[model samples]
Structures are given as C-alpha cells and as structure tokens.
Target: MSAPRVFVVENTLAKMAREPGGRNAEAAVKAAELRIDGVKDVSLASLIEKAEQLGVLAAEARASGESEAFGPVYDLSNAIYGVAGAFGLKGLAEAAFSLCDLTDHFRSGEEANWPAIDVHVDGIRLLATLGEKATAAGADSVLDGLRKVRARVMPAN
Candidate 1:
C-alpha cells in the first residue's frame, strides 16, 4: 500500500484556519489529521504518532463546545474528499464530504439533526476503514455517502 497523499489536506487546513470562525475550527482540522493517520493498508504509524500528539488538544477543544471548530473540520474533510477523488477513492472521499457537510448543516442552524449526521459520520468511518485497506474503494465509498446525504438534503422536485 502507498502512503496517503497529504497535498490536499495540508492546503485545506491552511485555508480554513484563516477564517474568522476558525479559532474553534482549528480543533476539527487537527482531529481530521488524527483521522488521516488511521488510514488502512497504509503504514501511517508516524502520522498516527503525530496525531496522538495533537488528538488530546483537539478532543479537549471539541468537548469544550467550541463549535466554531466545525469550520476547520469541514474544510479539512472536504479536502480529503478531493484527494480521494484524485486517487480514485471516490467512495472514501464522498463519505468524508458527507460527514463534513452534515457537521456544517448542524452548525448552520439544524441543531436537531444529529441522528442524520451520525449516520453520515458512521459512513465516513467505514469509508476511512476502506481507505486503510483499498484506497480506490474507499474513495468510492465516500462518494456514496455524499450521495446519501444529498438525497436527504436536496429538495425533491
């Protein structure tokens, strides 16, 4: 297995951190980095170790209800989707995107939407698992998750 590419994720984090709402959002970015470390079929022990270093801080911020952190997470997560797409990991990418979007939706005024968001997050974790084992399948799994979210959020015509 090849190392997961960090190109998109890194840049995405930088961009997201610039937002006025990024103070809390930064935690999500770190959390997402922690997530990337766990990618399967890839020897990311080094990355995982790094994630461990930051995970505690990120977790604390999240637990503190620094809701602004949602922005960074969404940004980083979206970038992950793009990376997945570039590597033909559409399922994994889409699933990640779905979770990001769900988080955004919840932040943007859908306070009572965790049930749906939880479903999306679950799909994202599954896709991430796939990414650890099969990059391509993981990307596609992400795409599928995104589609599911879209189906629920998009207006029926």
Candidate 2:
C-alpha cells in the first residue's frame, strides 16, 4: 500500500506557541516543538489501550443510565481526538471529535443518540487496530461510516 499522509495540524502547534505564558516567543516556539516531539515518542500501542479502556467505560456508563457519565465520555473522546490527531490518524481523530461534539450537545439538553455514539466508538477501535496505513487505504469507507454516525448524532441546529 502507498504511504499514509502525515496529518500534522500546523495550526495546533501555532496555537500552542501562542498560549499565554511568562516565557518569550522563542521559548514558546521551543515548547511547542517539544510537545510535538513528545507526541512522536508516545507508543501507539499504549494510546490504543487507553482508548479501549475509555470506550468500555463509556459503554458501561451508557448501560447504567448514568447522566454523570457524560463527563467521562467527553473526556475520552477528547483524549482520542488528541492522540489520534497527533499520530496522524485523521479518520480516527475526526470520528472522536464528532463523538465529543455529540456528547456536548447531549449534555446541553439535546437527545442522546446512543447508537451514533456506538458507531464512533467502533470507528475508534477499528482505526486504532488498523493504524495509519490501513486507515489511509480505506479512508473513503471509514469516513463514510463516520459521516453517517455524525448525521444521526448531530442535534438539529
């Protein structure tokens, strides 16, 4: 298969560099570079493990009808978003972001679309297992699935 596209979001780095701190501009740039380097050093296996654990927690919370579970689920989705985006897992990142948005909407008194959240969780697991190469290879199909779920979960606004 062809090499996967590196999905670096330069804007994220820029935003990090622009964060308010007592440090000077050069120091901020250095900090941003270090953050990116740190992400490179992270093990993908560990990230996947964390995502799996979060997914299970989300499922259990949903099953138990715990409204408080929104916080954990939202945090899990954000974690997935960060890790996947850092690792260039664009499909997974998008899926996780959509899930995060859906959870936020639900928490804001919108109807919870549990089935759509399941689809996002499934996408996260699938992309985590497949990694970047397979994800790039199957980008079209993966994105199609995510888009369908997003449509279902998105509050009419």
Candidate 3:
C-alpha cells in the first residue's frame, strides 16, 4: 500500500561501453547476419524440401486415417515459423505460423481438417517457391487468402 522502492538497473551494455573493451552491438549484429547468411541458401532449400514433404505427408496421413498427422505438421511448421522471418521470407513465415495455429486448433478433434491442412501446406509450398524479396503480383493476395482460409476453417469462437 506504500510507494514501492524502485531500484534502477543500469543498462549492462551501456556500462560495458563505458569500459575499455566494449564493442558496438550493431557491428556484432552485422557480423552475426553475415554468418547466418552463409547458411541461408542451404536453409532455404531445406525449408522448401520440408514444405514439399508436408504436402505428401498430409495426403498420406489422411489416406491412412492418421488423425494425429497434424502433430508432425505442427512440428515442421513450427520450425519453419522459427526461421522464415530471419531469412526475410515473410509470406512463408506467415503461412507457417498459420499452419501451426490451425494444427493446434484442430489437434484435439477426432479428425483433422484435411482441406484446411492441404490449403496451408500448399500455401507454404507456394510461398517457399518465391524469393525473399518476391514482389510477384498478387503475393499479398495469396497471403490474404491464407488468412481467409484459416478463418474459414477455424472460425473465431
């Protein structure tokens, strides 16, 4: 009920800067970006491969009655979600995140929403085919469609 004691913690990096051996955080970020860039091509290719695999898995899973296939889809999409932004694939990351959200929403059901699953996987693969700076016509429209489909499938409750 009294005035709280507020102990201010000094910015560690600013304190370090005042010292002799401090480094510019911006330079460190640039260096880190360069390192991550080294693996960008390989990572992008792997993501595409995973996206393709997701399509096949979704088809196979529905055929085999594996309602739990959303589990693997969630895992792969989550991984894609984690890294897609770092590589500047905004659409791909958005689709991946949508997929993850859809999977989570449908996971507890007795049957998975196959059409929604297919739409997301296809959307992801399509986005993966486009480059990071892709300004392809209707790209935003595609992203918008993804959001629409997610809404249609998993209506807000």
Candidate 4:
C-alpha cells in the first residue's frame, strides 16, 4: 500500500490569521487547526465502514431504477469523495468524483445507462475492499475502464 497522496491547497485559516484586517483571526486559525487535527484522527475503520455503506447505497439506487435515485447516489459519491480524499484513497476519490459527475449529468435530464452506474458501484466496492492498500496503478486501470464505459454511454457531441 503506497502512501496516499498529500494534497496541499491554500490554507485559508492560516492566510486569514496572517491578514491584519480580519476580526477573530486567531480564533479562526485555532478552529481550522482543530479541524485539521480532527481529520487527521479519523479512523481507517470508520472510513471503510462508510465506504461499505456507500457501496450498498449506490447498488440500491441502481436497482431502484427511479431517476430519484440519482439524488442519493450523488450524495453518497460526494461523501465518498471527501472521506477518500481525507484518507488518501485517491482512486476511490477519483471514481467517486466521476460518479458524481455522471449522476449530475443524469439529473440534468441526460439519459443514463444503468449499467455504467453498476460499474461505478463496483469500483467503489473494490476501493473499499482494498482500503489503504489500494494502488495508483489499480486505480488508474479502474478509471480507464470507467472512462471507456462513460464514453460508450455518452457519445461526444
């Protein structure tokens, strides 16, 4: 299991603390630091459990065949993206992001191919099973397969 990729973005709290004009800058920074610490302390077990639940939700949504299912599927994908990104599960995060986009397309009145959703759910399950042990190579392969499926379902305009 390679270490999860560390994404360093702008530290908004730190930036605000550095600015002279903001009121309660110190408190904001402290709150941000506490939030960071809490994220760091998130248990792998809990993340895995969430991932499992998401898989079930996605599968159920697919089975339901109601366009309304897109809502829950989108929400679950968002949750998976956040948790997976925090835990360095890059593949899972990427897959979830793709799934979110696909669901959004459907929500926007684009026709959805249910089989593609099934594939995405399978990819999420694979990442949940692999957890921290998931490899970038494996993730890339899965992403490639998903892209192929997406391309087939949604032909370029």
TM-score winner, 3 or 4: 3
Number of backbone-clashing residue pairs for each candidate, in the order shown: 20, 0, 0, 0
Candidate number that wins on lDDT, 1 or 2: 2
Residue pairs in candidate 2 whose N, alpha carbon or C atoms collide under 3 angstroms:
none
Query: What is the lDDT for 76 in model 2?
Result: 79
Q: Which of candidates 2 and 4 is the stronger one according to lDDT?
A: 4
Q: Between the candidate structures 2 and 3, which one is better when assessed by TM-score?
A: 3
- Report the C-alpha lDDT of model 1 over 35-94, residue by residue, as the tens digit: 765663253232233223323433443565656755665665565566655455556555
Query: What is the descending TM-score order?
Result: 3, 2, 4, 1
Give stretches of model 1 more than 4 Å off.
1-67, 132-150, 153-157
- With a 3 Å backbone cut-off (N, CA, C), the pairs that clash in candidate 3 are none
Among these predictions, the greatest TM-score belongs to: 3
Error of 3 at 121 (Å): 1.0
| Colliding pairs, model 4 | none
Write model 3 residue lDDT over 1-157, tens digit each, in one string: 8898878786998786689765688988999989999999998888888888888867766776755766887888998887788888887888899988888777767457777788888888887877565575546877888889888887888
lDDT of each: 0.55, 0.76, 0.81, 0.78
In model 4, where is the ten-residue run with the lowest total lDDT? 39-48
**Least accurate stretch of 10 residues (summed lDDT) in model 2?**
39-48
